[model samples]
Structure formats: C-alpha cells, structure tokens
Target chain A: MMKELRTAIRAIIVFTIMLGLIYPLAVTVFAQIFFKSQANGSLIVNQDGKIAGSVLIGQSFSSPEYFHPRSSFAGTGYDAIQSSGSCLGPTNKKLVEAVAENLSKVLKENPGVKAKDVPVDAVTASASGLDPHISPEYAELQIPRVAKARSMDVSEVRALVDKYTDGRQIGFLGEPRVNVLLLNLELDRIKKVSNRR
Target chain B: MAGSMWFLLFIYLFTLLVLSIPLGLFMAKVFNREKTFLDFLLVPVENFCYRIFKIDARAEMRWTQYAFALLVFNLVGLVLLYLLQRIQQFLPFNPRHFGAVAPDLAFNTAVSFVTNTNWQAYSGESTMSYLVQMAGLAVQNFLSAATGIAVAIALVRGIVRKETKTIGNFWFDLTRSVLWILLPLSLLIAPLYIWQGVPQNIHAYTDVNTLEGAKQVIAQGPVASQEVIKELGTNGGGFFNANSSHPFENPTPLTNFIQILTIFLISAALCITFGKMSGDKRHGIVLLVSMILLFVTGFFFAYKFEKAGNPQFAALMQRGTVENMEGKEVRFGVLNSSLFAVVTTCTSCGAVNSMHDSFTPLGGLVPLFNIELGEVIFGGVGSGLYGILLYAILSVFIAGLMVGRTPEYLGKKIQSFEVKMVMLGVLISPACMLVLAAIGVVTAGGMAGISNPGPHGLTQVLYAFSSGAGNNGSAFAGLSANTLFYNILMGVDMLIGRFAMLIPVLAVAGSLAEKKKVPMSIGTFPTTGFLFVVLLIGVLLIVGALTFFPAISLGPILDHLQMLKGILY
Candidate 1:
C-alpha cells in the first residue's frame, strides 16, 4: 500500500510536468514560430498604428456609418474580459422584451425597412458576446443606413458589403457571415480617399 | 431544415466513421501490446512514464488492485489540483494575478475535473491562472480521461479473458492511454487550432482599443494545446469563460466541425476497439449502431425545435431568417449550435458552443434527456463502451429469464452476481441525480441559485444535478451555482455518480474475469445482430425513462407547455 501510494505521487508529479508543462510549452513555441499573428490573438492594426481589435473577436458597432454585429450581453457589450451570453430562456420576459425592443430599434434606424426584412441575428445575443461575424443578411439590412450616413451611393456600399462578406468555410460548413469590423474599417478608408480627392 | 444542413450532418458522421475505424484498430493494437507505426518513437516515452510510476509493465493485477491504484492516483490528483487553485496567486504565469479561489468552489472544481466532469462553477478567464489551468486542470483533463479509458480497458479484459484472476495493470493502461493515444492526438490537433487562431501564449490578456473606442481585454493563454485535448479527451473544460463559443477558441466553421469530431472520435473508436479485442468486430458495430441511433434521435428533436425558432419571436418576424438565434454565433447559426448542444450532452463532453439556458424549452430538453439517458450515446471515452456493455449484459439476463435458459454473453454465463453489479452500475447515477435534484428544488439554499422562474427554474435546478451526477459538465449557465449549497451537494453528487457506478463495474469485471467460458449452444442467446441491439437499447431507454420521466415532466416538459401558453418566466 505504501509503495502504491508512493507510485501514485510520483506518477502525478511526472505526468503533470510532462503533460502540463513540457507539452504545452512545446506547442506554444511551435505556434509562435509558425503561426505568429494567429498565435498572438489575430489583432487587426489600423492605418494609424493603433491596435484596433481582433479580426476573430467582435466589438460594438452602433454608429450609422458602420454595420452592426449581433446583440451582446458581455460587460456593457463586447467586453472580452467577461465574454458571455444573455442566459435568458426562450420563455423569459427579458428575452421577449429585448427582442421586441431590438426589432423596433432596427426598424426605426433603417428607413423603409420592414420588420420582416430584419434577420433574427439582428435582434439576438450571441453565445459569446465576442462573436466577430454578423450574418450576411444582417449586414445587408444595414447597408442602406450606412450609405445614407456616409452620403455614399447604395450600390457602392452594397459592393463593399459584398467584398467583406465571407461564405461558409470551404463553401458548405457554417452559415455565411460578414466581418463587420473589416467592412466598417474599409468604409472609413474609402470615405477618407474620396474626401482627399 | 435546409438540404445543406442534411449534407453537413452527413459529412460530419462520415468523417467520424472513416477516422474512427483506423484509430479503433490502432488502440486495440496498442492496448494488446502489438506493434504500431508510432511505437518506435513512443515506446521510449512509455517506458520512462512506467519507470516514474514504478509500474511493472509485465505485472497483471486483479480488479481490486487495479481499482486501488486508480483511486490513489486520482486522490493524489484531486489534492494537487485543489492546492494549485488555492495558491494560484503565488504561482508564476499568473499574469492576471488572480487570488486563491474560495474554499467551496476550489473543492468543487477539484472533484469536478478528477471525475472527468469539468464542471466550472467559476468562469475560467477570471478565476484560473495559466499555471493552474495547465499543470492542474489540463493535467487532470488528460489523466481523468486516461483513468476512464483504463477502467474501460480493464472491463474489456474482464469480458474477454476467461478463468483468470488478473485483468491488467492500471498504471500500464493509464500510461498508455495518455502517451500512446491522448497525447499524440492532442499534439496533432493543437497546431490546427493555433493555425485557425486559437491563442497559444503565456502572455497576459491583451488590452486593445476597439473601433468604437472602448477597451477590450482579449484573454490569451496556452489555449490551442488545452483546447485540442479538451475536445479530444472528452474533457470539456474551457480556458475562456464562453468556452468554444468564444471566437478565439473556435474561430471558423471547420474548427467547430473538427471539435465535434474529436469529441466523439475516441469514444466511437472504443466501440470498435471492444469488438477487435473481444474477437468480434460485429458486436462493436452493433454497439456503435445503437449509440448512433440514440444520438440521431436526440439530434433530430433538438434541431427541429431550435429550427422552429422561439414562438415569442414568431409574431414580429415574418421572413428572412427566424431560427432561434439567441445565444448562438452567426458563424454557427442554429444548425451547428443545436448539433453541438446534442453532441456535447450525448457524449459526456459538456463543452458548450452555445448556452443551453437560452435554448427553446424543447431544444434544451433534448440534451437534458440525453444526459438523463446515461450519456452512453457515444459517451465519455472508455465510460461509454463499458456503460453500453453493462446494458448488453442486462439485456441477455432478461433474455435468459424470458426463455428459461442460462444467460450467456461472449461465451460467459450471466450469473446473479453479475446482474446485481450491472443493476447497481446502471441505476446509481440516475438515483443520485434525481434524488439530489429533488433536494435542491425543495431547499432554500438550492432555490437561491435559480436564475429563471416557474418551470424553467425547476429545469435549472434539475440540469445542475443531472450534469453533476451524470459526470457531464455542461450547464444551463444561468443557474448561479457558485454558492456553498450547490458546491458541496453537487460535489457529493459527482463523486457518488462517478465512483458508485465505477466500483460496481470493477466488481463485475472481477467476477466476470474469474468465470469460465460456456460454449455457445443453440440455447445461448446471440449477443450480436439486430435483436441484441434492440434489446440493449430497449433496456437503456426503459431504465432511463422510468427513473427520470416524472422529474423531467415537471421541468422541461412543463416549461415547453408554459411557453406555448405564452407564460414567461
């Protein structure tokens, strides 16, 4: 029994060092060497030399000139430190009221857009409040508002939205999505170039 | 559902089957001490581990010794993990410098991982330091899964070997499970995750100024390494609070698909391993098919309900997408989210890509039902095969009684002792789950943890105990389960759920190992084929439904009815 206990203790220490320390460190070193940007959080740097945000993580985009991501329940909205969902059940009053409010808000923000045109993603909270992508349909719904705000043609804004939209990975795996951050950033870049001219 | 949804499901299952057959055969080869492709490199490592463990690779043990070694190793692991969490502030790699965890939560977390139930009462990013996450929790992820696989392999030996006092060495099996199987798989997959943008760093969380000018702290860690094993080992603890739902952890649709496949891979392969080891691949396929059937049923129900969307939103939205998009990523949408929910629960892998608490009542009930059915639908690695095998034995026993002949399985007689052990193993988990859940609902302390009201609140309480006692770590998440009452009782629930079933399984292993083989005769019930699969599944459903039906009706079923009646809680 004593030998067994001794063996158990030694086993735990050895395995912990091997699996816990050595293995992960090895993987980290390999990742750092090969997949540098991805391993370092996939941060998107703006033209002004400032770290904007991650391409992989979503941030709030409530301005009229930018497309919006999903509704978030992260700290105040998109606080990566407290990534989480609004754990309200399907029958909860909070969820029902929130969705109704969001629908009305969407309709008010975009002129001539009906309730039927708004996608469900426009009114729902993502599992990770940090979800980076908006459904393509949600992105399309915001194009007219973004164009009106920027005084750009609807066709020009729509083309930019199309460029930012990503199809399902490998053509048929997940839902089609648009990276809101990238599209909004491009919108700013295009506005600056046009103003400079 | 779209035709695309059907195609995606087909691809997932086909990839799983194709990958698992080779893996299953390889595992059978490894455990049986046969040569394999990786042996030249891994054998030296295996020898090193055995030397440190002081295990005689040649020395076989009776079931008692095997159980003792496992218990002591796990006990040591439990103590070490608990201490790590308590003293994490003092440790290096604590870039956040988080303080020692509260006593009750620490104890709960320790037991949770040690039992292969990675139930997180506290969120990972805010609570655990890097060292603790790696050395403490991640280590257990590997070991606890190894422990489960070892027990299963031991049980397989019990069925295969005849008139022998010895099964196999626990330390040997444990070492091989980690070094030979879990480690290689994790190593291979970690790079994929890192390439797909799961962070693999020791740096502190990054503070970035967003385009909207608010500061966002992007949590970074040795995530790719841990994330791979988290799914591969069927240990679903997440490094980040939002788990796989966090974009950093599962960046793309391919990563999500890969994660699901990895979660089911080893557990599915083990069925094939059982067949190969027992000299009957057909029986393994039978078990695999039964599990697939159960999984498909649960997935169908969950997907249908989720796709139906929430009725509350049906009034406002007339077109465009109206699926239940709440608490689901746009990248995954309703289909992948629901599929992930069912997969995570059906197996003992409880890593959630979407929050179950926010699911449609019927959608949420599908996962709850899967867990209540013992998670034997491609269940936890070794645990799933042994679980289904126990049902196989019970089925034959029932068959024997019906025909007035002695029950035989794999050419061994099903005696009363075996039946008793089987009954104890099968029934103990649900008994603990239901009884403890009942206590939680009745008591004030338990009532305090509930976040939702009415029948939904009952579900939050029931889901916690069910997740605990089933050794499934997924949660309704809205349940404020960090309190003293939940921590202690659910800790007790997990321990009882894991061991009470485990010891009897070992006892059955011991008993079966000693029994001489009875030659198959005309009267001997065939343990393979359509009839046997039906019988095994029938026994599983009947036992599960009988035990959990009443409590379930009051919870999710009632919640669903209330939702239809426009009752909000």
Candidate 2:
C-alpha cells in the first residue's frame, strides 16, 4: 500500500510537469514561431498607430459615418470586458422594445435610409455580444450616410462593401459579413486621401 | 440542400471511411497494448522521451489507483483552467488585454473542457487570449482527450485481465496515447489542413484595401493545431464562433471531407481496439455496426427534415425553395450540415458548420435526442467506446435475465455490482436533467432564464439542462445561459453529469477487473454476432426511450406536434 501510494504521488508530479507544463510550453513556443499574428491577438489599428480593436470582438460604431455591428448587451455597448448578448428571445418584450429603439436610432441617424433596409444583425444581438462584422446589407445601408459624411461617392462606398464581403467557405458555410472596423478604417483613409487631393 | 448533391455526399462518406479505418486500426493497436506499425517507429522516440524526462516506461498501476490518478489530475486541471481565466489580464500574450472572466462563467468553462464537452458560453476569439487559447484551453483539449482515452483503455484492461489489480499506469497510457496516436495523427493531418488553406500562422492580422477602398480586418489564428485535435479527439469546440463554418478552419470541399473523417476516425478506431483487446474482432464489428446503423438513420432524418423546409416560411416569403436554408451555410448545403450535425452529435463532437438551433424542429431534435441517449453512440475520445461497452454489458445482462444464466461481456462476468454501477452511470444524467428541468420550469428563478415564452420556450429550458447534463455543449442559443442561475445550475449539472457517470464507470471497471474470465458455453450468447448486435441496439434504444420519453414529450416531441398542428403562437 505504501509503495502504491508513493508511486501514485510520483506519477502525479512527473506527469503534471511533463504533460501540464513542458508540453504546453513547447506548443506555445511553436505557436509563437508559426502563428505569430494569431499567437498575438488579431488586433487591428487605425492610421494614428493607436490600437483600434481586434477583428475578433465587435466594436460600437454609433455614428452615421460608420457601419454598425450587431446589437449587444455588453455593458455600455460592445464592451469586450463584459462580453455577452442581450440573451433575449424573439418573443421577449424587452427584445421587442430594444429592437424598436435601435431601429429608431438607425432611422434618425440616416434620414434617407428606409426602415426595411436595416439588417437582422443590426437589431438582433449575436450569441456572443462581440460580433466583429455586420451583414453586407447592413454595411450597404450605412453607405449613403458614410459617403455623405466623408465626402465620398455613395457608389464608392458601395464598392468598398463589395470588396470586404467574404464569401462562403468553399462556396458555402456562413453568411457573408463585412467587418465594421475594417470598413471604417478604409473610410478614414479615403477621407484623408481625398482631402489631400 | 443544393449542396446535398449526391456525388459530394458520396465522396465525403468515402473519404471518412478510408481515413478512419487506418486511423482507427492504429489507435486500437496503440491503446490495446499491441504492437502496431507505428509502435516499431515510435518505440525509440518513446524511449528517448522517457530518458530525457528521467522516467521509466514500464511503470504499471492498479486499476483503482489509475482511476484515482486520472480523476485527481483532471480536478487540478479544472481548478487551474478556472483560475487562469480569472487572472488572464495579468497573464501574457493578451494584446487586447481582456480582464478576468466572471466566477460562474469561469467555473462553467473549466468543467466544460475538462469533461471533454468543450461547450463555450463565451466566444474563443474574444474571451481567451492566444496564451490562454494555447497554454490553457488548447492544452486542455489534448490532455482532456488523452484522459478520456486513458480511462477507456483502463476499463478495457480491467475487462481483459483476470485476477489482476492493475488496470495500467495513467501517466504511461496518457503519454503513449498522445505521443503515439494523437500527436502523430494530428501532425500528419495539421499540414494537410494548412495545405487545404486552414491558417497556421503567427503573422499579424493583415490590413488590405477593399475594392471600394474600404479596409477589412481579417481575423487570423493558429488554427491548424486546434483544428487537428478539434476533429482528432472529437473535441468540437472551435477557436472561432463560427466553428468549422469559418473559411479559415474549413477552406474547401476537401478540407470539409477531412474534417468529417477526423471526427469519426478516433471514435470508430476505439471500437476496433475494443474488439482487438477482447480477442474478438467480431465483437468490435458488432459495436461498430450498431453505432453506424443509428448514425445513418439519424443522418437520413436530419437530411429529410431540413430538405422538407418549413412550410410556414415558404408560404409567407413566397419562395418556392423546399429547404429551410436560413441560418445555414450555402456552401455546406442541407445535406452536409445534416450529416455534420449527426456525426458531431453521434460522436459528441460539438463542432457545427451550421447553427443547430436554426435546424427545423425534427432536425434539431435529432441532435438533441442523440445527446439524451447519453452520447454513447460514439461518445468523446475514450468515454464514447466505454460508454457503449457499458451498454453492451447491460445488453448482456438483460439477455442473461431472460435466459436464466449469468451475464458476461468479453469474458468478464457481469454481476450484481457491475450491473448496479452500469445502472447508475446510465441513469444519473437523465435524473439530473429531468429533475433540473422540472425545477427550472416550476421555479421563478429557473423560468427567468427563458427569453422565449410558451411551449418552444419550455423546450429551450429543457434543451439547456439536457445539453448540460449530457455534457453536449451546443446550446439552443435562444436562451440566456450566462446568468447566475444558469451558470450555477448548469455548472453543477455539468460537474455531476460528468463525474457522476464517470465514477460509476470506473467503479464498474474495478469490479469487472476482479472477476475471473468465464468460458463461453453452447448456451452462452455470442455478443459479437449479428443477433447480439441487434440486441445491443434494442437495449440502447429501449433504455434511452424509456428513461427520456417523458422529458422528450415535454420538449421536442411536443414542439414537433405543435408545429405539425400549426399551433405557433
């Protein structure tokens, strides 16, 4: 019995260090070498060299000049620190009210945009509150407002939406979504270039 | 359903069959204590590894000690994983520099991965850092899976041995399983994934101008390694929210075929290993056939249901499409999604290329029903095969009860103690699920988590408990599962559901290990034969149906009836 106990203790210590410590450290080193960008968080930055946000987490873009991501229940909107959706179902009254409020806000911000033009993602929260992209339709809806604000052509903005839209995997897997941060960054660049011109 | 092109499905199935056979054969040989082709190659490497570590490869352990070591090791892993999430901000590689995860959520995640469930209430790309993803979660992915395989191997050792206390050393089995079986297979497959366009990079997220002069941030990660075990171990938790649905993880038809094959490869191989260990290939064949029969049946129904589409949506939208394609990937089509869903559920691989909640009522129920059947249909790594073996024991017992003789499985007599342990393992989840669902429905606190109301809402609650208790981590995504109430309840449910079943399984292993091998007589039932295979299937269905029928009636079954009766409110 004593021998068995001693053996068990030794096994735990050795295996824990080897499997738990060394193996993970080795993998981490390998990952750092091979997948440096991904090993680092996939952070995106703006022109000023300030960190914008990760492509993974959704950011709030409430202005008419930027495309908006899905609705979020994260405290104060798109708070990555508090990553969570509204957790509201289709029939929940709070969900209905929240959707209505978001709709009104979108309509108020972009006057010419029709209510029907709003995408489902624009009003509905993603399962994870930190959805980084909006549907193509949602991106397109912000085009006119963004173009007018940035002094770019609406067609140009529309073309950008087309450019960023990722198609389904191997012709199909998921709905096409345009990353909001990426679009806004481009819009910022276009504005600067046009001003120089 | 457009992607359901018959040719594609055939190709996918054929690839899965071809790859799984060799992988399964190799895994079986590795785990069952036999010399494989890889054994010859891996021996020197194994010796070298042991030498560097200053360890002996020949250390053996009693079955009870083995079980205890595994449990204690994982218990520590659970605590460490939970603590790591809590203190991640202080940890390194956190460029976005996220803060600590909440207590309940952390606890839930810790239990989730440790139990081999890999159910994520939080998104991986955001909630975890590269450090945690690799050092913490991904490491757990390998170790947790190895743990399951070790447990299954221990149980098999128990059954195969006579008058022996030693099941095998936990460390040795775990190391061998990883070094020989999982790592080599993953190394071979990871490159294929990279070649197929799955990302394996450390390059920073690239910024490129869109055609419209818009900049887009492409989310990149160390995907190849994760993708390897994600399929190899049947640990389906994705690094991305979209899981294999994302192009980065699954780039092409070939990658998709590979992913499907990888999910079932280890699971199917374990069955062969069981047969090999028991000295009866037919015994393994019987179990394999039983699993295939159920899986194919479920697959067909999921296909048909999704293809049939929702009639209500069709009339309202004025679209003539006969498939419910909303929330489904157009590339995967209904057929592939249907197959993936069945394969994932059947094997306890929760990786979904499409939204399971968006599946039509019956289609959704198929996966849910698979979980309710206790995930034995080809469960997680080692757990699945052992779970099925438990069912095999039960089948034999029932046969014995009918024939007025002592029951035996793989030469070990299935006696009263074993039967009790098997019963406890089988029934524990249902008891937890049903009781919890009842508590949730009746209590104000429980009902508060419901975001959807009425019958469908009730079904969502039931689904949460079922998913939690069954250790199948896919959620309806229609419920608020992150709240304190859900976190605690589901956390506890997951803990009990996992360990409760596991303890009994281990106990049965210990008991069976002590039993002397019984010689087969003319009157003895041959479990490897077709008749016994059918009997095992019958036992699986009957036990599952009887135990879960009431709960099923209240949830998916009733919901199906409501949909059929046009009773949507």
Candidate 3:
C-alpha cells in the first residue's frame, strides 16, 4: 500500500509537470509569437493610437443617437471585472419588476414606441452581461431615433444599420445580429449624407 | 424560424452521424493496438510512458486492483491540482498575481476535475491564474478523461472475455486513451479554434475604451488549446465564465458548429467502438440510435417552446414578436442556442451557448431532463458508454424476467450480485441529489444562493445537485454557489456521483468476469434491434422519470403551468 501510494504521488507529479507546466507554456509561447493580435486579446484599435473596445465584449451605449446592445447587469454596466448573468429565476418577482422597469424606460426613451413592440433582448440582462451584439429587431427599432438624432435621413441611417447587420454565423449557426459598437462607430463616421432616397 | 431550426438540426446530425463512422473505426483500431498509421509515431511514446510509470503493458489486473489503481491515480491528481491552485500566487505564469484559492473552493475544484466533473463555483478569467487554468484544470481535463476511458475499456473487457480472472491493465488503457485518441484529436482541433479567433496567449488582460468612452477589460489566456479539449474530452470547464457562449472562446459560426460537434464526437464514436468490441456492431449502433432519438426529441421540444415565445406578451403575442429571445446570442439565434444547450447537457459536457436560466420553463426543463436521465444520451467520453451499458444490463435482466428465463447480456449471466451493483449505481446519484437538495433548501447558506423564493429557487438548488451528481458542470446561472457550504456539499456530491457509482460499476465488471459465458440460445434476451432498443429506452425512462418525477414537478412543471396561466414566477 505504501509503495502504491508513493508510485501514485510520483506519477501525478510527473504528469502534472508535463501537462500543466510544459504543455501550456509551449502553447502560450507559440501563440504569443505567431498569433500576436489574437493572443493579446483581440483588442480593436480606433482611428487614434488609443485602444477601442474588444470586438468580443459588449460595451455600454446610452445614446439614442447610438444603437443599444444587450442590457448589462455587470457592475453598473459592462464591467469586465466581474462577468455574470442576472440569474433571475422564471418566477422571481425582481426579474419581473426589473424587466417591467426596463420596458417603461425603453418606452420613455423612444417617444412613440409601445411596450409590446420592444424586443426581449433589449430589456433582459444577458448571461455574460457583456453580449457584443443585439437582435436585428432591436437595431431596427433604434434606426429612426438614431437617424432623427444624428440629423441623417432615416433611410441613410437604415442603410447603415443594414450595412452593419451580420447574418447568422455560417448561414444558420447563431442568430442575425448587429454589432452595436461598430454601428455606433459607423454612425460617428457618417457626418454628411443627404436625402438621396 | 422553425424551418431554419429544423434545417440546422438536420445538418448538425448529418455531419455528426457521417463523421462518427471513421472516427469510431479509428478508435476501435487504436484500442485493439492494430497496425494504424499513427502507431509508428505513437508506439515508442506509449512504451516510454509505460516504462516510466513502471507498469507492465502485458500484465492484466483484477477489477479490484484496476479500481484501486484508478482511485490512487486520481487521488494524486486531486492533491496535485489542489496544491497548484493553493500556491498559484507564487507560481510562474500567474500574470494576475491572484492569491491562493480558499481551501474549500480548492477542494471543490480539485474533486470536480479529477472526477471529470468541471463544476466551477468561481469564474475562470477572474479567479484562476493562467497557470492554474492550463497546468491544473486543462491537465486534469486530459488525465481524468483518460481515466474514464480506461475504466470503460476495463468494463468492456469484463463483458467480452469468457471467465477471465482479470480485465486489461489500467495503465495500458490510460496511456492508449491519451496518446492514441485524445492527444491527437486535441492537437488537430486547437489550430482550428485559433483560426476562428480563440486566443492562446499568456498575455495580461487588455484595458480598452468602449464606444461610450467607458473602460473595458478584455481577458487573454492560453484558450484555444484548453477550449478544444474541454469540449473534445467533455470536460466543459471554460477559460471564461460564459463558456462557449463567450465570443472570444466561440467567435464564429464555424467555431460554434465545431465546438458543439466536438462535445459529442468521442462519446458517439465510443458507441461504435463498443459494437466492434462486442463483435456485433449493431448493439452499439442501437445504443447510439436510441441516444439520437432521445436527443432529437428533447431538442425539438426545447426549440419549439423557445420559438413559441413568451405567452405573457399580450400585444406582441399576436404580432409574432413574443419569442423568448432573452439570454440567447443573436449571433447563434434561437435554434443553435437550443441545440447547443441540449447537446452539452446530454453529454456530461455542460458548456452552455445560452443562459438556460432565462429559457422558457419547459425549454429549460429539457436540458435538466437530459442531465437527470443520467447523461447517457451519448454522455461524457468513456463515462457515457459505461453508464448506458449499465441500463442495457438492467434492461436485459428485466426482459429475461418477463420471458420467465434467466437474464443474460452478451452471453454473460446477469446474476444477483451484478444486479445489486447496477441497482446501487443507478440509485446512488438520485439519492444524493434528493437528499442534498432537501438539505440545501433547508439550510441558510444554500438558501442564500436562491434568487427566487419558490419553485424557481427549488430548481437552482436542484440544478446544482443534479450537475453535481451527474458530474455535469453547467449551472442554472441563477445559483450563487461560490460559498463554502456549496463548495463542501457539492464537492462531496461530485465525489459520490463519480467514484461511489464507479466502484460499484467496477464491482459489476468483476462479478461478470468471474461468471462463465453462456452461449446464445433461443431463450436469451436480446439487447439489439428494435424491440430491445425500445426496452432499453423504456427502462431508462422508467428509472429516470420514476426517480425524479416528484421533485421535477415542483420546479419546471409548476413553472410551465404558471407561465401558461399568464403568471410569472
């Protein structure tokens, strides 16, 4: 029994070093050298030398002039220090109240939009609380407001929304989505479009 | 939406079924140690490992000895991983300078991985260092899976060999499982994930400005390698807390498809290997077909309910805008999200692509049902086959009793001792789940994790224990389980769920190995073809439904009824 225990301990130590220490370090070093951009967190760089948001994590956008992403229940909003879902149960009254509160806010924000027309993704806190994309419907809902706010024609902003829209991954893997960060960035770039139908 | 969901489902199934054939055959060859192309390269490595471990490749072990070796090996791994986490602050490659994990959490995480249950009370990117994630968690991902496969191969040997005193050597099975199968598959797939945007660096997290001018932290790590094996081995421990749902870990539709497929690849192939080992490929094929049928049924139920939308949306209900799109990634949509949920839970892999907590009550119930059904619908790698085969044994025993003859499986008698062990194996998890769940609700610490006060609260605790007892690692996302109470209780559940049942399974193998093989006869109960398949499935449902029905009614069923009545929980 003692010998067996000793053997077990030795085997584990050896395997641990091989797999835990050696293998991961090798992969990490190789990736750092070869796949630099991705290995370093796929950070999206803006026009300036400064770093913009990741193409991955969703960010907080409060502008009616900009499109809304998934609701963040992260610390305040989109706080990456802690990542989690609202984890509200189906029957939880707080979840119901929170959704109701969010709905009223959406209604108050969009001057003429009704409560029922609001997309669920717009109101609910996403699992990661850092979901990067919003439903195409949510994006579409904000188009008129965004266009009106930006002094761009409704058609012009709609066209940009369409441009930013990404179909389901590989035709049918995920859902159709519009990256809100990229869309808002595009909205910023479009300083002067006319009423050219 | 429904049409697209169906289309995607068919494509996923088609790819899975077609590909499983070659992979299955390759695994069979690898197990048999037959002349294969990779043999030339891997042979010396395997021999070297055996020599270094002081194991005799030609030697065989009795079932007890095999179980003992496995326990010792896993215990060592458990200790090693535990120590690694405790001392991570002092370890090299800990870019975050994270301190040692609390002893209870360390204990929980250690048992979790060693048992092939990757349940996390703590978030990965924040709490764990890169060193712990790679060396500790990922290493156990490989070794634990190899151990499961080794036990399974030993059990298969017991089934196939006629009155032999021993099963195959544990070391041989472990070495072959890792070297010949898991290592190659993980290596081959890691590059694909990297291409699709999963990171593999040891760099510190990058802080970048958001479009709103708010600061955001993007975590970086050796993700691609860990990501592939986490799925391929059915380990399900994600480098990120959001698991496969996180865009960084699963970026494109291509990565999502690959990830979902990899979850079931080894498990499904092992079914084919089972058939080959039995000298009757049809037996394993029947098991696979049953698994698919159950899987497809659960998948559509989940999809239809999710696509049906929230009935509570009065105005939007008529406008066809009431769908439960909450917590689903629009990048993957409703169909892919539902499919990934069902697929992950159906195996021991619990990597969620969607937040199941936000699913429609019945839709959420499907994933829970899959786990509660013992995850045998193509369960985790080696664990799944052995689990379902236990049902196959019990079913044959049942079928024989109906015909008024002695029960037999693959010409081996299903004696009293074997039946007792099988019954114990089946009963143990449910007992743990129920008892612990009851304890969890009654206790303040467990109650602290509860988000809602009623049935939904019941489900959070139930989900925790089910994930525990099943060795599945996904959470309901609503449960705050990082506390010391859950760490200790669920840690015990994981150990019981894995090892307690495993010991009995090995006992069954031992008992069967000692019995003489009876030749095929007119009176023998069959486990192949349509009738036996139906019987095997019926046995599984009866066991699952009977054991779990009352507790399930209080949670999902009650929640579903309330939702239909326009009552929110």
Q: Of the candidates numbered 2 and 3, which has the greater TM-score value?
A: 3
Candidate 1 regions off by >4 Å?
Answer: A192-197, B318-321
Q: How much is the lDDT of residue B375 in candidate 1? A: 87
lDDT of 1 by residue, B457-491 (tens): 88998999999988889999999999999999999
Q: State in Å the error of residue B201, model 3.
A: 1.0
Q: Write the per-residue lDDT of candidate 2 for residues A37-80, one digit (tens) a residue.
A: 44445456667675665554556665556676666655566554
CAPRI verdict (incorrect, acceptable, medium, high) for model 2: incorrect
lDDT of 2 by residue, B1-569 (tens): 34535555566556666766676677667765679777778787667655654446577776567767677777777877888899999977666676899898899888888777777777766677656665567667787788888888888888888887677777778778878878777767776666555665434444443323434455555667677788878777787766776656665546766787788877787877777777777878788889878987888888888787655444333445346544444335566667778878887678876666656678888888898888877777887888898899999999999999888887788888999999998999989988998888998878887765656577677777887787777666657677778888888888787888877887887788788888888878788789998999899999888987877777666766765565554
Lowest lDDT 10-residue stretch of candidate 3 chain B: B312-321
User: Which is better, 1 or 2, measured by lDDT?
Assistant: 1
lDDT for model 2, on a 0 to 1 scale?
0.71
- Report how far residue B266 has shifted in candidate 3, in Å: 0.8
- Candidate order, lDDT descending: 1, 3, 2
Q: Encode model 3's per-residue lDDT on B368-476: one tens digit a residue.
A: 8889988999998888999998999999989878888889998899989999999988889989988999999999999998876677778878988999999998888
Clashing residue pairs in all predictions, respectively, total: 0, 11, 11
lDDT of 2 at B375: 83
Error of 2 at B530 (Å): 1.7
lDDT of 2 at A188: 69
